[model samples]
Target: DTRKVAVFVGSLRKDSFNRQLARALERLGEDRLEFDHVEIGGLPFYDQDFDEDYPAEGVALKQQVRAADAVLFVTPEYNRSVPGVLKNAIDLASRPYGDSAFAGLPAAVIGASPGAIGTAMAQQHLRNILSYLDMAVLPQPEAYLQFKDGLIDDEGRVTNQDTREFLEDFVDGFVEWIDRQRG
Candidate 1:
């Protein structure tokens, strides 16, 4: 069966680079993987009391995360960590204590930033949470892209050849890693 990959775009902006990264991954993996692009925009902050009824949206988000075999986190750095909305969504899915939707899933995180360090620091911080959730993160082919002015065209297609090559390697690595974990 084709591996199911639910990609989470951490930025909600119309032209977020992270969204572009998610799109690029989808384009490359066209047939080999099933991609579910989940949105975090409408999820209200997670609260214990709300678990009773568990609004349809919250339940749907959890189902989406749980149903996927793996995840691709395309995130943006905000104040040296992932954006608040992204974190909120994760917390929402990791609900009811010890029943996290992401538990035992394989995942790869890649980030691009307009600033220098690319999102290295932010990714590390995210690791701490993912670790606690027991996620199996791919260790190789780490992607942290820095500012690349005009590297992507008006259509949001990545145009930098070097970055393009890196992305190719990254996707291949992720597929291989997913196979290994599945096996």
Candidate 2:
């Protein structure tokens, strides 16, 4: 069975490494997973004042997430944590108390960075948030990839054999994770 994944790329940069990583995953999992790239860059800062009447963009974000069979967070580390835009998007989707879009959704987190440690700290922070939001996050085979130039090409192809194999393993794990969650 095929599952639809709402993919959230944490960075706004047009050619961000994390986005490339997300695209690579999309390519790897194309047979079993359909990826929908959720737009978070245009969302306004989440506000409780608007909880009763959320902004249209925020509502759309929540709807997209709610429609997905699973969620994938591809993030970049900034200041040793998740980027502000991603946090804002999460807050928007999980607002208004009992109406969270993320609750009980199967999820996975992965990231790539030029730094040695990759996006470990940021992924940790994001996992904490996902737990709080009640997502069933995958716990094994954590991916904190150290991205080099041309590791993933513009067409979302993994250039190196080892990197491709690792990502394939991650994708397989994610597909199993989703099945376990929904089974």
Candidate 3:
């Protein structure tokens, strides 16, 4: 069966490595997964006051996330944790208590970074938060890609064959994980 995967990229830069990874995952899963890159750039910071009467953009974000069968979080390491924008998006969707859009949703995380750690700490921080959000997370085949220029082409394709194959395998495993969650 086809599944809809909502992709959340942590970086806001035009050519962020995490964004490139997300696009590569989308391309790899083109046949089995319908991927939607949810825009978190315009979302306001999460505040309890806005939970009741959320802004139109926030509402749209919630709806988009809730409608997806699964989530693919592609993030960058920002001071050893997730970026503020991505965290804000998460907090925005999980609001008003017991009405969190992310609850029980199947999710996975992968990240790329310029540092030697390859976003390891950031992904761990995100995984911990996702657990609190009650998301069913895939635990294996974790991707911690090291970033480099020219890794992804203008066409959103990964240039390195080994990296491409690894990502493809990760996508395949994610598909299986989603299926397992459904079952």
Candidate 4:
């Protein structure tokens, strides 16, 4: 069966490595996963007052996430932590005190970076937030890819054989995790 996934990419850059990573993952899991790239760039900074009358963009974000079978976060480290934009998106989705869009969804976090540790710190912080939001996040086989030029193409093709194999395994594990979560 195919699972719909709401993919949240943390970077706003037009050519971000994290976005490339997300695309690669989508390609790798295409047989079993249908990816919907959620837009977070245009969202206004979350305001509690708007909860009474949520903006159309915020409502759209929540609806998209709720419609998905699972969630995937592709983030880049910013000052050793999760990027502010991603945090804002999460806050916006999980707000209004009990109308969270993320609750109970099976989720996974992965990132790619030019740095050696990839986005490890950012991923850890994001995991904590996801846990608090009550997401069933995948805990094993953590992927912290050290991205280099030509590692993955803009169209999500993994050029390196080793990297492709590793990502394939990651995708397999994620599919299994989603199945287990649904069961």
Q: Is candidate 1 or candidate 2 better by lDDT?
A: 2
List the global CA lDDT of all models: 0.86, 0.94, 0.91, 0.94
* True-structure lDDT of candidate 4: 0.94
Deviating ranges (above 4 Å) for candidate 2: none
- Candidate 4 wrong stretches, greater than 4 Å: none
Q: Cα miss at 148, model 2 (Å)?
A: 0.3
Which residue pairs clash within candidate 1?
none
Ten residues in sequence with the least summed lDDT for candidate 3:
51-60
Give the per-residue lDDT digits (tens) of candidate 3, residues 28-142: 8889999988999988888899866878887888899989999999999999999999999999888868888899999999999988889999999999999999999999899
RMSD of each: 1.5, 0.7, 1.0, 0.8
C-alpha lDDT (0 to 100) for residue 50 of candidate 3: 89
- Looking at candidate 1, the ten consecutive residues that score lowest on lDDT are 147-156
lDDT of 3 at 171: 94
Ten contiguous residues minimizing lDDT sum, candidate 4: 147-156
Off by over 4 Å in 3: none
| Candidate 2 vs candidate 4, TM-score winner | 2
Provide the global lDDT of candidate 3 against the true structure. Answer: 0.91
Q: Please identify which of the two predictions, 1 or 3, would achieve the higher TM-score against the true structure.
A: 3
Error of 1 at 175 (Å): 0.4
